[model samples]
Target: MDKKGYNTKGRGGGNVNEGGDGDKWSRWWWGLSHRKSAPSEESSNSNQVQRSPSQSKSPKQKIRISSRSDKLPFYYQNWFLVLLTLMSLSCFAFALFVFLYLYPDSIESSPSSTSPASSEVVEITYGTVLKLMHEKTKFRLHSHEVPYGSGSGQQSVTGFPDVEDSNSYWIIRPQPGTSAKQGDPIKSGTIIKLQHMRTRRWLHSHWFSSPISGNQEVSCFGGDSESDTGDLWRLLIEGSGNIWRKDQRIRLQHADTGVYLHSHNKKYSRIAGGQQEVCGVQDKRAENIWLAAEGVYLPVNGSE
Candidate 1:
């Protein structure tokens, strides 16, 4: 159509028909209309007039909205789904209960085996060992040694004995410190008088002494046949195998006298069989040492 002869269907027709422009436009926008030209489709359908391209539109583009998807299923989107669902409610209630009841404690206490608050300690003594069920717990000797003491006077010392014949045995508990777990080794030479920190409470200071009386024949580990010259603070607990006196080493032997700790004065330490120096002295009996030191000095039947 010629620019001037193109049809104008509505009122207000102009002498010039820009709609019939000589320049080519691939398609007419739904809204573009020359003031002197026919109405746009938007004008015809204003009810659906949402987006319309323009002859001179601003840089900003318009948006068009489509429809929604299928609504959520009843089970999934039901407003009261949790309120009436027994299983879901139970789970929810249980979750809420766990969260409310256990979460705080978990955060605060963090129940663990190593926590300081996880364990408690109690003080005890060698006697405490007697209370333990022997069938359930095994006795481990962390350490043992003769009471360190002096004197050849160990006899009938009943004033302090806890048993009828303490020198012969021990009936008290094994002082335990850092109780050994099952299978742990029992240190043979461990000095029971001194307790490790973990077992400090169970170590009774009384274990440091023995109950011996005067009148018992005491021989110094390195003295002559005359008198014993053993350290005033040395005692022996057990020994065997051709034992001899070392200046420092002593032995407890079951001789004609009894279970006695052979001892000598500090000066006569480590004597031998030769009568010239004669120092292989045996205490002969527990009642031979007077003031015992740092040992559960058995009277004569106090312990094993």
Candidate 2:
């Protein structure tokens, strides 16, 4: 039962009398600030302040500190809401973790199944070329897929190789367009009949190889360089047709291939259209103005 009292053992003590003229708060203020003509704390205060690098707070102090936020009503401070929110988030995280652990694959992904997949087909056609570059390169030919109409009264024929005398070469077979490979065994009724006149060109760098219809240009004696054939050579040949689609180009990958012609007896020229024809040493000797094409009026004898 030690109540707060004054100490007067030294001259450094305060002059607080037992019967002071004030209440507790005033007394405390007087004790801290008021004094006779004594020196200030700057000159005489000698109590050393003991501090540890780290302090272990007492249980009472800890309880007092923790009670500050806890004792307040929900409207008094924001910390209660913050703590509640953190606790709710922790609980939700724990629930999510447990759910994922129990059913890993069942968790709905951020990109739901309703989202579009990467495997959708996108159609792209530019200028004269209607190219469809896709992961799946091959397309199965169907009679409906063939670009033919109920009219044109056209029929399919064989012996394209026999006419060319080179099975290694045939023409770019129409519809179900394919790369340089064996022709697929299409249905018998399937044939390519066009209402518009079909045309193609053979692309050669050195000389006029041939074209599906028009005359071909050659590097004069047809060398790989333009110097071998000058620009002064359009009048030497003939050019017909007002509109020849540049997209309608042919690749003379080899000499063995020949184009399929329909029932038309008119003579037509052909040439390489795509790549600049590059010639090597042996190509110089082959004057056989790279046969572009041989026209036909009948399918049976169309090979040139």
What TM-score does each of the candidates earn?
0.15, 0.15
- Candidate 2 structure quality by residue, lDDT tens digits, 185-283: 212223221111122211112222222222232211111221211211110001332221121211121221222211111222222112121221222
**Over the stretch 145-165, how does candidate 1's per-residue lDDT look in tens digits?**
222244432211111112121
Query: Candidate 2 overall Cα lDDT vs. reference?
Result: 0.27
lDDT (0 to 1) per candidate: 0.28, 0.27
Query: By summed lDDT, which 10 consecutive residues of candidate 2 come out lowest?
Result: 139-148
Q: Report the Cα lDDT for residue 11, model 2.
A: 52
> Candidate 1: misplaced stretches above 4 Å?
1-71, 74-77, 83-201, 204-304
How displaced is residue 118 in candidate 2, in Å? 5.8
TM-score between model 1 and native: 0.15
